[model samples]
Target: MAVLQVEKVSKWYGKHCALNEVSLEVPEKGIFGLLGPNGAGKTSLIRIINQITGPDSGRIFFRGEPLKPEHVNHIGYLPEERGLYRKMKVGEQCLYLARLKGLSSADAKARLKEWFERFEIGSWWDKKVEELSKGMAQKVQFITTVLHQPGFIILDEPFSGFDPINTNLIRKEIIRLKDEGASIMLSTHNMASVEEICSHIALINQSKVMLDGEIKEVRSRFKESIFELSFKGQMLSFTNALGTQFELLQHSSDADLRLARVKIKQGLTVNDLLQRAIPHVQIESVSEYIPSMNDIFIKVVEQPEEQMV
Candidate 1:
């Protein structure tokens, strides 16, 4: 089931197009990655989804119905920019935001107490927002965003100011939320995060969506049919064995072993490469070289505009 759909969406700032004919469907109960470099119109599209602004030409749907004003109540948005009140006490601010989301006073307090305890920040409830460090403040804001139990959540750069431990904490919480049936749209430049949590992704570049699909499918689509092999043997013998079926992309020496990155031609498999080289070398490890999301991001974004066309 799709929780959100954008059809032929386009946005413009004066005569300059910010998003052009972009369309994507986000599945229910899954994390969808909205990725791109700076000035790629990702924020424009996100703003349209949040109804902060209207699209120049397009339509959006939520839960199979036309997106309406009331849908905003069902969304919990954490924009890249933090918006906490500097002078407001932590507990007070959380209760206020919860009330704004339609929670009763008593219910808001109960939920805030639980979240504060779970996040291990209960002792800081009375502290002013300004008294907290950036990561600490981020935790408070994150708790407030999810306090109302919104059906759809949008997190923009959710891990921006955290150390590794806190980053992992947020990651675990995100997974837990998805497991509990909340759909999320995660917008970030962190490709590793996308790889770790996203079920599917839509890659937008220069106002256009260049790619969209399941993570594994997208990686396979861009695979170069390469493999990395580690072995202990004469490099010349191994290279000589691989005459035409494979091309050696790189060769390097680790302390006592030879490492070779080889690309096989189409229709050739790892078995073929192994068969040819195993006779001459003692193979320690043989693994396919699938490009990481970071590598794919650079390759796609750096492509010429005409090629993307």
Candidate 2:
């Protein structure tokens, strides 16, 4: 079941439309990537989901019920811009935030301690928020946001201030949260991270959803039947064996093996290409080239609005 459903939601600021009929569904227990470049209206859609702002048009449903203000307790949001009382002690501030989320004081303390230790930042509990570096401060904010263990999470640029190690640490925790049955909507420009954790994704451009689907399905649809073949043979014989069913796009030699990228002809399959080449060349490996999310994002965004899906 989808935990959150947005139907033709739109928002605007006076003469400028920030979002135009954006619709998407976040599933119950997996990470869904809200992908778009800067100024693509990602922030607008996220605000509507969090109830921080209302859509000028369209509706949102949370687990089949109409979205309401009180449902904020059911979600944990880590905004792109981090905010915490500068002079507040990390531990004290975390406890306050957790209690605000409806946790008992005792439960909040226990959860905060567990997370602090796990993240190895327990020593900073009594330290002032301003004393910590940007990355450390982000860690505290992250802890407080997730301490309540909400059923759904909205993380906007969650990896921004972290170094590589912390980035990986947060990535692992995101996966753990999903495994524990929390639905996550991750908004970021890091295509590598999206490919790592996102089960599904929706690409937005100019306030419209350009594409949306399971990651594998989207990649397959964008793939143009290109395959990278690794084999050892005379280059001429290999090209001649291809006949007219395939076009050799590019080829290069790495040591003794020759690697070539070939596009299959219409009405032909990888097996057909193999059948033609196996007799003339020694086939070592054959793998279909699937476009990455970054590739798809670039290609899709470059197309005219009328051509987008």
Candidate 3:
């Protein structure tokens, strides 16, 4: 079942339209990526989802029920722009925020302790927020955001301030949360992370959803019939064998081994290409090349709006 569903939701700010009939579904117990370039209305949609503002048109549903005010308590949000009370101690701030999420003081404290230790930042608990580095503060904010054990979590640019180690740490935590039955919506420009973590994604551009689907399905939908071949043989023999059956897009040689990327001709399959090349080259490996999320994002965003769908 979908954890969240948006139906033709639109939002406008005076003369400017921030979201134009946007619609997408975030499935239950998995990570959903909300992707778009800056100024593409990602933040606007997020705001509407969080109830920071109402949509000018259309409707949203949470688990089949119309979204309402009480739903806020079941949703946790960590925005792109980090906010914290610099004067407040890290533990103090976490406790306050946790309570606001409806946790008892004692429960909040216990959860905070567990989170701090898990993040290896227990030593910073008594320190003021101002004393912590940007990354450290980010970790604290993340703990509080999920402290109340909300069923759904919205994280925008969650990896913004972390180093590679911390980034991986957060990535693992996100996966763990999903395994524990929490639906997560992740918004970030980091396509590599999205490819690694997102089960599904929606790409928005010019205030509209250009594409949305399961990651593998989307990649297959845009695949260009390209394949990579690794073989030990003369490059000339391989190219000559390919002839009209394939278009050699790229080729390289290292010692006795050679590699080539070729696009199979229409009506020709991988087996066809293999049969044709096997006689000329000693085939080591053959794998189809799938476009990365980064490539798909660029291609979709650059296409004309009318062609995006």
Off by over 4 Å in 2: 240-245
- Give me the displacement of residue 159 in model 1, in angstroms: 0.4
Question: Tens digits of per-residue lDDT for model 2 on 186-209?
Answer: 999999999989999999999988
**Clash number by candidate, in order:** 0, 0, 0
69-134: candidate 3 lDDT, tens digit per residue: 989889999999878999999888999998888889999999888998898898998899999888
RMSD to truth, every model: 1.7, 1.7, 1.5
Clashing residue pairs in candidate 1 are none
C-alpha TM-scores of all predictions:
0.95, 0.94, 0.95
Whole-model lDDT for model 1 versus the true structure?
Answer: 0.93
Give per-residue lDDT, candidate 3, residue 5. Answer: 97
Pairing residues by index, what is the TM-score of model 2? 0.94
Lowest summed-lDDT stretch of 10 residues in model 2? Answer: 300-309
In model 1, the worst 10-residue window by lDDT is 300-309
Q: Cα lDDT for residue 201, model 3?
A: 98
Expressed as tens digits, the lDDT of each residue in 3-68 for candidate 1 is 999999999998999999999999999999999999999889989999999998989999999889
- After superposition, the stretches of candidate 3 with alpha carbons farther than 4 Å from their true spots are none
Error (Å) of candidate 3 at residue 47 is: 0.8
